[model samples]
Target: MTWPLQRLTAPDPATYSPRQQAIHDQIASGPRGGVRGPLAVWLHRPELAARAQDLGRYCRYDSSLDQRLSELAILVTGRVFGSEYEWQIHKGHALKAGLEPAIIEAIRCNRRPDFADVETEVVHDVAFAAHRTRDLDDALYARAREVLGEQRLVDLVGLLGYYTLISLTINIFRVPPLDGGAAELSDV
Candidate 1:
């Protein structure tokens, strides 16, 4: 409620150029199954839309991290940014992906989640440390390396970076969840 931004109206499909339409099609028909959120905003620039969605596809699906970890990271990003739309969409995905409800609640409340799994704990620590301090301390870095291993560690960092952009976009555009639900980050 504090930083409510002016929301942009989605561009009419009829107004889309060939490139925009093509990119829209790519997004609408791809793994995401719809042109929504940041991709919807980026559609005004077809190339940006195309590239963003592609990167998003990789980050969301093809990354080395499993879907559970990925959703956890994304939920952290959404909570950190206080992005309503981001949190609203990913919260269910996080739960469905098998992230514990308690962990989700902790993140939603902006408190340290009590993760039963070290991987979840590591991800939360790494992401919170990175976002809050803008860098992971050596101890946390080593821990992440140990817990996540090299490739997943790399993917974790990538997921954080990409989701930062996503959070920024959602916040800047004041994108509401499709459901027009109440704000999830109100307490935070």
Candidate 2:
């Protein structure tokens, strides 16, 4: 499905104030090139923007979970939430992390993907649990703990919460899904 581009009414970046430019620069160097809609909103509020950038940095760069699991959790959450923007952005990252196309497609369709191994399964379970409940049952907790240590497990939960927040914001704002100029959601 094509998504519309939600054009910002803000002034052009070339004419931005020094503070705005700084925020823009921080986003540019951060994950997803800081061009994401949510981050763009944060930029309009400088203090919040800085804090958001720092959180983004920690989640994207300093998280204890490895890249593959991180991407898995993100993709699963995006898929479950039907946040097309998030799905569009992370699908490529998921692919690059060696996730199979079939698996990605499965996730996009909200199915239980066939994981290559146990680690991916753990990530998937955690994501499912996060969406399905606030508390993890004993079985789920044990499996996660067995696969990922306490620290990494906590980080995994944090990642889930972070992306869940992102999904909520983007969906609430109706952030347009990415379009390569073919068909716009606005036209649909």
Candidate 3:
């Protein structure tokens, strides 16, 4: 499905309302280099924009899970939800963060991905648990606790919840793939 809104022009800070201008400035410094579609829409809804920005900052920089593991959880959630937009966007970040290409492919297929170590296992376990049950069970909870510690395990769950929200929003909005990009499911 195509995205519903017109493709946004590169945001000019000077053209924004005061609140949106601040958001635009923050987006300039965000990880993806510029604010794209979901954010461009949120700019008109400041509270939601702020919430999204907070989620982005937390997931990308402040989450206790290492980047690779964090991304694995995200990919797994996207795959489970069949969110093409989320899977496509996060796959590149996951790869750049050192998730193996083979494992990323496996994630796209909704299989158990092979991981290099126990840290990766923790990510897969928590994601599988969350996706299947909408909550962790005793065995999965124990494993997560043993591997991630209380704080990081909590953060991991938060990250999964955050990304799942993002996936739902993007899918419901029919947020288009980045301009000129091939559709993710097409290749798969």
Per-residue alpha-carbon lDDT of model 3 for 141-171, expressed as tens digits?
8988998899999888888888777777666
Give the 10-residue window scoring lowest on summed lDDT in candidate 3.
1-10
**What range of 10 consecutive residues in model 2 has the weakest lDDT sum?**
179-188
Best by lDDT: 1
Model 1: CA > 4 A from native: 1-5
In model 3, the Cα lDDT at residue 175 comes to: 65
> Rank order by TM-score, top first?
1, 3, 2
- For all predictions, the C-alpha RMSD in Å is 1.7, 3.5, 3.0
Q: What is candidate 2's lDDT per residue for 46-81, written digit by digit as tens?
A: 777777678767876799977877888998888777
TM-score of each prediction: 0.95, 0.84, 0.85
Model 1 poorest 10 in a row by lDDT: 1-10
Best by TM-score: 1
Candidate 2 yields a Cα-based lDDT of 0.75
lDDT of 2 at 82: 74
Could you arrange the candidates by lDDT from highest to lowest?
Answer: 1, 3, 2
